[model samples]
Target: QSEIPMQKPFQQVKELVMEYPVSENEPTEENSYLSYNLVVGDSLDVEKCTAFEVLDYVLLSEPGAPLKQALLDAGLGKDILGSYEDGIYQPFFSIVAKNARPEDKDRFVDLIKETLEKIVKEGIDQKAVAAGINYMEFRFREADFSSFPKGLMYGIDVFDSWLYDEGRPFDHLKKLGIFDKLKKEAKTGYFENLIEEYFLNNTHGSVVVVNPKRGLAAQREKELEEKLAAYKASLSPKEQEKLVKDTVHLKEYQDSPESQEALNTIPLLKREDISRKAGRLYNTEKHCQDTLILHHDLDTNGIGYLELLFDTKQVPERLVPYMGILKSVLGYVDTENFTYGELSNEINSRSGGIYFGVQVFGNAWDNKKTVHMLGIKAKALYQDIPFVFRMIKEILGTSRLGDEKRLYEIIARMKSRQQMSMASAGHSTAVMRALSYFSETACFQEKVAGIDFYRLLDDLEKNFQERKEGLIAALKELIHYIFRPENLMVSYTSDEAGYHGLEGEIRELKAGLCTEEIQGEPAVSVFEVKNEGFQTSGQVQYVAAAGNFAEAGYHYTGALRILKVMLSYEYLWMNIRVKGGAYGCMSSFRRNGDSFLVSYRDPNLRKTLEVFQKTGDFIRSFQADEREMTKYIIGTISELDTPLTPSAKGSMSLNAWFSQVKEEDLQQEREQILDAGPQDIRNLAELVDAVMKQNRFCVIGSEEKLQQEKELFQEMKYLL
Candidate 1:
């Protein structure tokens, strides 16, 4: 342990392990959780640090990595997540066991240590290390920062060393040479040594177990009420009087408008300064034999982005849940040519990755129609395009999908994730639920991803044995029905050279494509449940109220964008966030007339809805000076002009086509947004009143809170 060289001496490793036990209100859908983080030393130098980066992908982050497989095999949790966080001075390795039991916390730690010990003794797999090094280098070299600015990412990386060390602000960015050196050193057992130094022998680590407790949020609320009541009881009469005055004064201050002089001092981009036209993404539809190709020829730095869209109308509504399970099954399932592990490793070593999902897009021209497309999205460097196509062919054509044991694992993991998403961001769930009463697009969304999807996962997991055969048959039936070339449409984004080469790849891929006829009649979706309460163990609530203004005899206009800004920032902000003490609130009016108001992390359920109910009054009395109005217009335009990557632009163009949105429509909307006035806002009062008057709403939050206001809901039940 003392043989390693260092610039400075450090504390000796402790003999005992440190364990931190934490308790929190977990979603009723999941159990306890544990995060086993081992202190894996610091970013003192580049070579060792970059090696750790590569080790992360090899160990757990990459799909079907050995560590993830080990944990899954041990039956510790449904989904195990592992990551290497180097944003701080001292980087640590984290292994999270989701949907874990409290009693299994020690087992998680022990299993992690055992896994690393075994790796150290038997040596890290050379294949994994090679794949890991290649992947890390590819990501850094590509330098695609998602949607964030490149300089911003670089600045954040600079902090990795600037804050801890006095010198070398850009130390972390010098990874190319270190990565190359580490790849060569891998054959010398450099990574195995790291495993020994950091994990097997390192005692400066902690096992954090977060135990879930039912009714914790309700208990805490009662304690807070008691504490506040006692504090007020102890206040003197004069103090209480002053308290009332102070609170009134605060509200008055909040209600007051900003001074014109102060507002004028802020910089402005006048209406004439910005463009009135919208930038349309490149879309030139071309036809190859028996398939539609949506070619978005853009400069993607020699990387090709491909999308294979197959219409899902042929898939009966009952099989929608199985579609989600199928997304997880493909690539992970054993193919005719390759085992699951080999397939996953080959993917990581060669190209970016392949993903499959069923998407629902609302028609821009008609709200009743939906573009139900099952898409195969993938990316690869120009040179690796052939490999990507070959893999896709094998997965769609030759993959076996009826494995009972494997399907059970996939379904269990999805059920855990469904519960987490509803707990963390229930606002989306609530809004979808509210809109599902009328909008077919929203209805389809609810079936695939909303609470209904969660129920499907729950049912399958609960009775896997009895339903295994049917589930397997459904998977097979869907695969044959979905992968047919009859309805296949392709979207490709690449440079001119790559674009030309795509036809050949598609021609080869076409041979493997399914072209079977349907054996049975497809059934339509049937489900309607609105004005419902979704109960969760979360302390706060996500309250949503939505209605279709179109159905209410109201037409959509561009002026509504400015009105949205006012309601979201001025009215809803003050009432729901500042005064009501909720974390956030939003008001949105879409062109298709689907308007919704949603609250995030809100404490009071009824008060928030009451605020939504008064939204029409706020719009009717809307008032603002010209200068203040310009700010709202500028904010809306800023959102419209957010930066996009080439691939994103390509995907957006395809989406717009599917949704039936025209460039002229976008331009008109921008012009109206720029020219909107106080009258425009007042004119929207009718639309707001129409949408809010119906009172179709859904809430997901504390069980106790939902029970207190149970009359607001037609049905109340647990989310899972």
Candidate 2:
């Protein structure tokens, strides 16, 4: 090394800054625009930071790209480019990154071309594209997006309108024609746009300058924070302008007759034919007078009631109090007579039963009847419907924070889950929408006077403390009026033949391919053992194995999963499945269910000798792990703690209710998995061993799989 310090050893440092004109002066036809999009795949190596690397690769690959850097650098002091999932059928990559460089901009165009070429040459998997499309279709088919609240749609639409006005490229969104197609098909991919737009912050992408070294990240963070602070400080002028406009809006609304008339009217939940009803307008002193009667019948227990809604277009300002009272009285779910639980049970039990829910819609001041499509299903075991209803009514009619304790509990659980692993994208979106609605629903504010809403809440809360019986009587009376025997109906089956035992509950007698569970069949006797020490004690047969492929085609983890599920199933029904104690004992694979296990429906318990003999063959007949297992471990960890959607939420709730598992217990079990290691799985497999031996298994099989194994059953019975 030369002694540069001795001579004139000083390395001059300077920021290499580049500038480009905002527009390339590209000529364009009127009403025409240019758009470009970028998608990057993610790898599951948590230590690898594929997401970070991809962004860095983008920046390093295209030096002197200010537009790109701006989007990536936006996470100044935040968690930056949050959690990402790996190896899901859905697109694991993001289309959040976008730019509006003109089509004719040579440099920008050349840059995209270069990058796309490199990506393909590096081996872009066509399978990924097909997987993405299939995932989208499956998601659309399974998802219940209609459950999303209208308020959310309204808010998102307003937000989008603002973005449109600001001239942002919505490349993540399908093209106008494509968007319509997706909307019509109800493609799950349609949601991908919103997921990317909101979750990925695709609308306003980040730009980061990538230097191949790690040390620069700290310096970059500091510099980025200062820059963003300065930019935010500069927005004061625009904010002030917005404030003035809002004030003007308030004044204009105050003087509007429609607003005044809406304020006077008290809204009610109509329980008859709302569609055929019409709105009648009248001239009055307070402002205007109108009667818009609405009725929608939801029958429960052969009862129906008529809901007469009279919206007064004119009245004294004090009339708002009366409106408030009406809302408080009418809003509680099942508060009218029976709780929602009672209604659901009565209806489902009777045959095909229905339940009614009501809502008011419109703007913040005066709005119109917008309640026709709101459906509420309250679970008795998992949710307190009456309490939830009270909370909802209280929030809508009175305070902003109804059920504050419950909300905090829910948010805390969600936040913890997010910190643990990458949550399922679909589930996360669903949860946020649901919770946000419950947290900030003001659907009734516009249709009725805001004052009325507040007054009704106060009246309900006050009356509950004073004349509780009278209030209950009023609610029951309302319920009686709506759920009268004449108003509702359901089909009933009185024949005992239709009521089968638990084993015969799931039958496919009418189907082309049918399976049946015969009586007195030899089963593994895998029944739940209650009063057990464990919090969760239900016995389940593991029936399949599917593994994540790692390192090209290696399936080590997949093999382990297959072995575990298979062994458990076979061990339980040794004589029952293989030795002909029962028919068709085998394990299968389900790609979507995220599990690999063995299962047996029918087990020949009587043939314990042959069953024991078959276990050795089952164990010896399997292949060893053929691929890297670490990837499967990582993927499993990522999904186990994912957030809940209505579907997931409902499923989890039902599981807990039926299995007698508490939410807290599940959380504890998850937390126990501090880090997914081989030992964790080994222990889980061992547990399966204990469970298979003790529980009774159900048999759903063919007589053929069992007839020949009668000797095994006889031997086991003789030994016993």
Return the top candidate by lDDT: 1
Model 1: CA > 4 A from native? 1-30, 43-50, 520-523, 527-529
TM-score for candidate 2, residues paired by index: 0.21
Summarize candidate 2's per-residue lDDT along 597-698 as a digit string, tens digits: 223333332343235334434444433231223334333333453433333343343323323344454444333332334444453343233323332222
Model 1: how far residue 209 lies from native, Å: 2.7
TM-score for each prediction?
A: 0.93, 0.21
CA displacement after TM-score superposition, residue 233 of candidate 2 (Å)? 90
lDDT by residue for model 1 (677-702), tens? 98898988888989988878999887
How many Å off is the CA of 181 in candidate 1? 2.9
lDDT of each: 0.80, 0.29
